[model samples]
Target: MNQNSKISEDTIDLKELFFSLIAQWKIIALCVILSLICAMLYLRVTSDIYSVDAMVQLEESKGAASAALLGDLSKVTGGFGQKSPVDAEIEILRSRMVLGQVIHNLNLNLIVKDNSSGIMDKFLSQGRSRLTYQHDAVTFTNKQNSLIIKQLTIPEYYSDKPLILEFKDSNHFTFTYKDQVVFNGKLNQKNTSETNKGLWAVDINAQGELLKQSYTVSKLALPTAVKNFNAIYGVSEKGKMTGVIGLSYLGQDPEQITQILNNVLTVYHQQNIERKSLESKQTLVFLEKQLPELRKQLEDSEIKFNQFREKYKTVDVNAESELLLKQNIDLEKLKIELQQKQAELSAKYTNDHPLIRQIDAQISEINKKIADLNNRLTQLPETQRLYLQLYRDVKVNTELYTSLLNSYQQLKIANAGEIGNVRIIDTAVEPVHPIKPKKLIVLILSIFMGGFIGVLIALIRNLFQTGVKDSAQIENEFDLPVYATVPRSPIQETRMSILKKKKSIPILAVKHSDDIAIESLRSIRTAIHFALSSAKNNIIMISGPAPEVGKSFVSTNLATIFAQSNKRVLLIDADMRRGYMHKYFNLEVTPGLSELLSQQVSLEHVLHKTNVENLDVISRGKSPTNPSEMLSSTFFKELLETLSPLYDHIIIDTPPVLAVTDGIIISQYAGVNLMIARYAKSQMKELELSVNRFEQAGVKVNGFILNDIQRSSAGGGYNYAYAYTAQKDN
Candidate 1:
């Protein structure tokens, strides 16, 4: 049972909140409309960004020509299979060396713009390129603006500072800096001038509207230009180890970004070629140094072999000696080649390195073979051995020289034919559409976002409302039974409209007998009838926590309901200040309660008859200085005692309990004391304080009437509905 009750409470709170939001639908609608307007404006002002991209692949192998040129030396260099990693190559593409060249080629450091001053011009220019034309130079011109800068140079300190170029005609123009004329020059001619500030140099071509509009030109520092360019530049491998890179750049102009990206690819390709050629060039230089020495050594060996033949004269060697000579020469040639390979490897690697150590071991083995061939040569006859030694020296030198010469020419050819291990698969092209400012998506999101904010605001307002909404809440919280929950009436609203227009109010219960509010009052009448049965006298005092809680409305209308039940009723406005109850019955304010209380008028003179049968009215008289004193006097008590017995029911409308002590004092005379709390306006704390004030004065409030409820204040099931038409139900 407890759990079910908790669930019921939760459901009611949610239902109440839902209705609260419904009550504030206008706020949410306004927010949504505002959001849509802002979204449209943003779409208008944001420039379209076109994206251009290029695709390139990195080859795992160095060029075939380079590998072939190295020949045997390819083993030492890691051969054709060696290539830089994809990640490293990607970084190199974005390096300053590569991108800086692109920037310089495109002349990106200079900026030019049309001097658009009007709101329309600036608005229309949002999605346009800064310059009308850009290639080797930048050009900008319109009906009211013209500027073309072929060359511009400014000192470092003046970089990024804007200068205005105003034309006097098609041929002449003046450059101004900070409103000061810096230089005057003719178009299509080189101009150079020095001022106190800095030297200025420029070459310009101008046309159309030269005198009507000026243009702004600013030079950016090279580093700053490169940094700005890098902001839009992007490059990455398509997949891990794929070696396929995708490059992209975003900008307003389709043609400019396309050209820029293609240029970047071109420059990167050229640099890669240069990088590959550098290795072959280094190897050529090393080989060339050995060529001259090897040539001279071969010459000396030939001369010595001929001289030895001349000195010995008719020298002959046995076949065994000849065999040993060929063996020795072959061994020596192999040994020399090993030593040369060792020397070249030593330049790049320490002797302790694995490759170097392996080469050293091979060279040692070749040297031992050479030594054994030398011993076989020593076994020959003395003259024959000497002749064989010269033959071996000449053969070894000739073979070594020829090998070095061939390798040198191969390297030169390879260097000339070298191409980098990178290939461009697709070049960037002009984009047909922009990639940004997705209109549908942005507008859709804005709608949701705006609605979300509106709902949040509604919920926040509901959370902050401290007023009593539910009549059951007052009953449960304050332990005071609410006799009736009176809904707002269109008839009452019409009466208020008439009263505002200075007309009289029609008593609601008589005019709208079947009205829901009247029905609610009938319920209150029943409760009052039961309470009056045990009362000291038949009188009810109606007051509220604060003004504007519909206490007077309840008091006047409730009396009309009792009068309709055939009971003689008297409605008295006891409030001496700011009471206008007489307006309801088309009566004047003076000569009523205040006049009667002060004994300035007799009872018959103060009392007035209303249009409703069996009802009498007494309006609060003209403003008084001492109303509290008069109401508490014996005369007021005797007046009520005198009038109470004559009426079946008497309702006294008093001032707000919190505003003054009049209601508390009046409560002492009435048998039934009731407080009227307006729905969604009378705060719980305020009502609690008002009740406390009455209890402290030793008067117990009989009950409360929750008044002027709107649909939102009455949460779903128990909420009352009314048919507001003059047509009778058949």
Candidate 2:
């Protein structure tokens, strides 16, 4: 039964914790709203950027097959093979040779102003003037000046001489020779350099048709505005490499952007083809050098074989020489067997095989035998010899030379047929959609980041908070019982404020509402009765660790509760620095404690009646320089002793113990000292320090009065009241 009750109590405490968080709902809501607003503002001002992509497919080079054959031959000769087509193409695409040609063909260095109209359009076009004349003479006029040209020609006799020119306004004329000013007066001529001469002159002889040409140049030079235009390539999705080549301008001109991209693409394609063609030309040059050498070797071998046959004396020997015929037949049979063995050995083993070894030994023995026969034949004279070996050597060399010559011819033909290994399977097309500035993705990420930051800030602020926000925190930290809780009173606005603005108050005081401050005081009153019922005296000391924490208010109100029961109750303001009971009761602070302690005035003279029946207050009296010393005096002790017999319950309001030692000293005189802690205002450390001070002074604390508890389950609500009542009845 006891265990069940204990579990029920823990659950109630947990509910109180949740209720305390509900009390701070306004702060949490404000944080969420502000975070959302900031996120939206960031999304509004940011600009969206777009990206476009194009795909280009590259094909493998056709020359790779022939190159592979040549590579095999080189490998046999212990040399390196040719590079693959893909590797060569990658370098060709990135080469500066291709990029440079693209730049030049596009006229990338030329700076042409966009024809689109903008803020500076009028000013840029201001000085431009066009004029046509029947003869050579023309006149130019503007607001500031006017010039009359008698004639204008190019590369004539007057081009070498300085021509006099005049500029006229309403008041005066300025004379100039060529473009240099000679004087501001009438008809002044000045010598000018040949370079300074303008393209204006006169000629007496004229052609039948008037020369018509308009030499257009900018009248004024403006600052150069340069924009970098380049193509960027990177890998994209779908397992293919892509490129986004963009052209942009700072001064809002869409037409120029289109023209630039069009020109760049045209030039880029031309350069790419030209680069591939160059590689093909290089391959052709290499084939041209090697073809003739192979052909000459083939022809020389054939001529050598014909000459050897003519020089050698060899005739047919049939039945006349039977032994020689038998030897020739055996040689023919051995040659065929050797060939069959070689064919089989070629499939089974390398050159170092046992069959090759046996064939070499047999060939050496046969050559020796042939040499011996030839020597014998030479001894027998030229007519007797019929065998020949020179023709056989020539035949083998001729056959090998012919095969090599044929291969060389085939290589030349192959090289001529070679095309570029790489070809564009697909060209880049115009993109239909932009690829960047995803609005939905950015908004979602921003919201998440904002919420994360809000939580981080809240947690950091919560860490530094030292006040007792909930009763659970106090019980968990100090291991103390929460006696009672009082609900907070409704804030009252002044009548002048209400009358002038007619603003209605949001909340009003009620008899049975879950107000935090009121609920806390009622709990404290119940604790007092229970504590005093077990003690000898009902005298209680109400004190806190800090000022302005509702200590004095709680003391006065608690006295009023006891006095309402028709019990004599005395409320004393023991705080010397800012005792507020006298002011609250609209009475004088002087001639109270100070006069009574000095024995100049009686205790009855200092005790003032409040508006409430049976309730009286003893003010702190005049401000004293030495409050701690006066609070610890023997006279103050005797006063408390005198008041003890007069009132049924005497509630003393003392200054915060942390601020001074007056509260601690006064607590020693009172029968029971009840420490008051304001909810969400008093810190746990301050409470511990106050309790420690009392213990060090050899004074026992009656218990703690948890003031300003939020009117919730966690703050000991109706269930707590029922428990207290049950305990009292028992």
> By lDDT, who's the top model here?
1
Locate the minimum summed-lDDT window of 10 residues in model 2: 721-730
The residue ranges of model 2 lying beyond 4 angstroms of the native Cα positions read: 1-45, 61-233, 240-268, 279-437, 465-481, 485-514, 547-550, 556-569, 580-614, 633-648, 678-688, 707-730
Provide the overall lDDT of each model, using Cα atoms, as 2-decimal numbers: 0.79, 0.51
TM-score of each: 0.78, 0.50
Model 2, 1-730: lDDT tens digits are 2454446545545454444445444455566677667656554443333333333344444343234324344332233223334334444434445434443443333221212323454335454322312222333333233233332333233322343432253333333445665334321222222333344222221111111111111111111111133333332223423322222221122233334334434554566454434433443344344346545644665576566546664455434344543454355434433433343234435779765676667666766765655454455334334233333333433443454345446555554554543333333334433343456666666666655665555545544654775555555555566665554443321231342233221222132234444444555666677778887676788888887666765676667667766888888887777775675566777777766766678888998887767878888888877878877788888888878888889998888889899888987777778877776578878998988999999887776666554435533433232111000000
Global Cα lDDT for candidate 1: 0.79
